[model samples]
Target chain A: MKTLSYFLILAFSGGEHAGGGSPLDVNPGLILWTVVTFIFLLLILKKLAWKPILKSLNDRENLIKESLEKAEVARKEAEKLIAENKLNMQKSEEEAQKIIEQSRELAEKLKMQILEDSKKTANKMLEDAKAEIERKNAEAFNKLKEQVADIAITAAEKILKENLDKAKQINIVDKYLNEINKN
Target chain B: MYTGQELIGADTLKQVAETAKKTDTSWIMHDVLDANEIDLTPFGIIHLPHLNLFGFDISITKHVVFMWIAMLILIFVLKKVAKSYKSSLIPKGVTNLTETLILFVRDEIAKPTIGKGYENFLPYLLTVFFFILTCNFLGLIPYGSTATGNISVTATLATLSFLVIQIGGIWKNGFFGYFKGLLPHGIPAWLIPIMFVVELLGLFTKPFALAIRLFANMTAGHIVILALIGLIFILHTYVVVPISIAFALFIFLLEILVALIQAYIFTMLSSLFIGMAVHQEH
Candidate 1:
């Protein structure tokens, strides 16, 4: 029976371990209490701990996902704005260049026209001054000649008191001189 | 230093153990049988109250006290984490730790094992994991008791798991349908009775294994550590002291790993069982 008990102990742990108490000792009381305790613990934990924690975790996940999407949209918008700005700047620069080119051409044409007009007016003024001087010289020469003729006639009259034949001879001589001069 | 009769102290210990066994104190029996005594060593043992109801010994024992402590610690820490989450979703410190573990249970244990309708059983899985983990860790303390080391406690957990699997299956598949799903699609009628018995046995054994596995694993580690320390005294040799302490520490670290692994296993198995029931092909 002792040998059988030892075999039993090996097979089924019928004997106690270490000291007198075996950890495998069955207790109906403990089992009953444990069942009750575990159920209550589950209930209480499910309410206080599990519900709020899980909800918060889910909320955090959703919030993160949404934030990432919004960031992506904002980045795209910024890129578009930058592209538009570059395009506008390029267009305006071209227009400014065109305006500058047109104005330079206009300025060159106006300068050439002004120079030509001034040169023509200066030549005309010189011609008019020369003509006036020549006319004045001619008038003076003609007056002087008339005066000489009158002086000769007066002197001859004074020498011969009522000599019409002498005056007529002098006039015939002036005429002969005038004819020679004309020839 | 082989004093040939160094084992004489063992006989003395045996005498003391026998004397302890013979003591008329009502609580000693409860202590040995049900883990009714919480050994505080320096502070002295705490004997919980024993109660009888309808000829049933429904007493609150040491395991109960430890279990309550584990539960309270779980609630307190997780409650703080939950509250912290309200202000910001950014997890820091304890929240980070809890979040990592919580997600592990969900993604690793519940999701893969339970498959499509995994969300419903997350609460139970998470509870069991955290509760068992805390209980297992408690045993590592200087004089702390492992509630999970107790057979009754582990058995109770297994029973709850069994109930959940059954109830969830019944809810998904009607009573007869659930039972019918257990058998393969087309089988000989003679094989029905044999298959039924085997399947029924499979149901009970799965939970039974859970209970035994957790209890044995938890109890065995502490026992090994204790025995290693006791070796120095038993041999009456100073030579074994460092070796014994070193080995004990090693076992202690291993126990910590075992604690986490056991909790994961318990939760994983529960989820697997739940999946088996709810997601039957038939």
Candidate 2:
């Protein structure tokens, strides 16, 4: 390698003087140096620098992506839970309204039952009073009839004591009763 | 270009060597074009060893020194970021800069351009990006030569990518199939030979252009900045120095932009070439 490079350099530098010392002189040594240095740099830097740097960048990107996805999942779950709670709250309110409507119906039925019972009692009392009044009226009428019959017999005795015989008087009273019935 | 800077530097060396001679004057375009020496204008040339390890000149050039410097800076910065990764996923302080640039290259350059199986080519993409960028930045700082501006350096880089493109193509499509995919469908039988030649030429020209584009961009920006600064010397007046400095400063700022852009273009094109080879639809 050293002999190869030594000869290469002599040819380049020797050729420079021969070519009248132009600044555009091409040297084999500089070319060798450049190639060697670049390859060295590429190999060394690839292992030491780029590997970890790119890895860390990739890792950071993955981390951020995972965190964002987790946050999105959490947000969706929270929204679902809120919706469930709202639905439950609405369902309970509907049940409460239904119960109130049912109780009102029961109260109305009870009021109607109480009114019917009171009205029936009042009608029965009025009927009982009427029956009692009718019985009293019948009693008074019977008593009056007895009194009138007695008075009539006394009057007949005083006016015509020997005029009419006992059998005839009974017959005349029967006839009067028949006439009253016919009229 | 370093050549422009080295022009002034070379003559100064020549002037010192012949101190008994009359003073040297003025930078010529020829000097700027022909300078092939080390550039250390402020400091006298420090003679680096030119030992023959075997038959070649094993002497280090200014560009190589700067290349090594760029490499060290990269290793230092990246290793520091690597250390932070060991502790935590989140980067801190200067490590953030390293990671941000790395991710930008991966996401913006490699991932979209290479599409599926981008990870396999990531190390090469990252290396080329940071390497070219660091070399370009080193040029902007004081006393640092642009290694990427050197034709040989850029060519070496292109050659590596070319190997990856071909080898990957062969690996994916088999040797014959890889070559077969080079030709477009529905071409007449008579045109296949001509088309194949053109396609083969295109394969080489693509990477060739990649090399030249980076070398030319980096070299051109520096040359423009140097020329702007050299204007004061050319005009031989203190009056124009302020204006020259102003323009030079503007171009220097612009060079900074060009350096980064050139590095990005090099890496982006490399990934695209690799993708073409791997997919082989074109």
Candidate 3:
């Protein structure tokens, strides 16, 4: 192997220096030596070097793959949580809209009920006022008629210039009261 | 003594220019290293024509010294990183960072392809990946040699992967079973011989593919940076320093990215090969 390496070095250097010959003008001895050396190196390395290096690389690869899988699963879980939150928000919004509509309807119903009640109350008050006025007028008229009859009786008694008998006066007054009462 | 100038001469430079004009294999190097020569003393220190230290010199070439330092850094850094391993504790610092890479190769690369007994192959795959990656990256430094830029280096690395596939397959499946396994299951009796030949050829082709891919990618990036820097010299020798530096730096940064990509591709392909061999279904 060493000889092969040396021959290759010489041949390559030669080719580099002067270049009229074919590229394949290789020395067989060097080729053989190279082959032998390569095999030797391979054996030594296999025994002493490769195991540790390969092990480290494999460990790194596995570590990377595992981390990637974990990240993927976590991302999926986060997405699911976000979706659930969005659905809940949509449901709440709909519920809030329903509640607002119900309250509006209630307010409208209450307003209409108050309007109807006030109209009924106002009609009742107007009817009571008319009945009260009629009662007062009738009382006043009856009292005036009684005062005029008393006054007319006193004046007739004075014009006759005679003392009227108590029984006949009583009888005339009763008869007049009865006639007024009847009328 | 081996400075960049010592290795290059007017005649050699002329030859280099001529080669560049004619062939597809020309390489470009910008004036990043203000040295006379690219030295190999550091790599040549321990292993030479003979592995012996005759005498030590204080004034060694900087590039050579730097190469030694780079290799030591590669070794020490890797060792230090590996030393941090324990059964229960979490890996820390450089160890932790590398541990991650190790695990990747074991689980994603070695284990998946090699199947039930993948643990056995983890060490090999991890080493190959790191070794090649380190070598490729080191070359990106200014005045550095791309070890993988050389076909021999790549071929050797490829060969090792090839050997693992072959030997491991043979061990698991048995010698006779290994050969028989190569043949397609549904081929007619007459066509079995032809199919067997094709299958045998296919086995060899996989490693060759590995070799070419790594070598080309590593070499290509350097060439691009070199070419970009060389543009100022080729187009106009004087008064183009700023423009050359800007383009060169831009490509140099791009080369860093390319360096990493090439390393990754090499490792991935090796793992795929192991997987193919271990799992006979395909």
Which of the numbered candidates is closest to the native, going by highest DockQ? 1
Q: DockQ, per-model, please? A: 0.28, 0.22, 0.09
lDDT by residue (A1-183, candidate 1, tens digit) is 443444454333323442245667667777776777677777887888889888888887898899999999999999999999999999999988988988888888878888788877887778777887888888877876776566556545543454568777687668656754673
- TM-scores for every candidate against the unseen true structure: 0.78, 0.69, 0.54
Over the stretch A85-107, how does candidate 3's per-residue lDDT look in tens digits? 99999999999999999988998
lDDT of 1 at A65: 90
Say which candidate scores most in TM-score. Answer: 1
* Chain A: TM-score in each model: 0.60, 0.43, 0.49
**Which residue pairs in model 1 clash with each other?**
none
* Candidate 2 residue pairs in backbone clash: A6-B55, A6-B56, A7-B55, A7-B56, A10-B57, B1-B223
What global local distance difference test value does model 3 have?
0.64
lDDT for position B41 in model 1: 68
Candidate 2: lDDT over CA atoms?
0.78
Candidate 2 vs candidate 3: which has greater TM-score? Answer: 2
Candidate 2 residue A115 Cα shift, in angstroms, is 14
lDDT per model, in order? 0.80, 0.78, 0.64
Best by lDDT: 1
lDDT of 2 by residue, B166-217 (tens): 8878888899999999999889999999999999999899889999999889
Please write out the lDDT profile of model 3 over residues B1-282, one tens digit for every residue: 345544454445556546555543333432222122454455542322211233422122222333344445655666566445434345778877776666666667766666788776666666677667766677876446666666655776777778888887888778888888888788789999999999999989999998898878877767766766666756656677787788778877877887777767777777777767766767
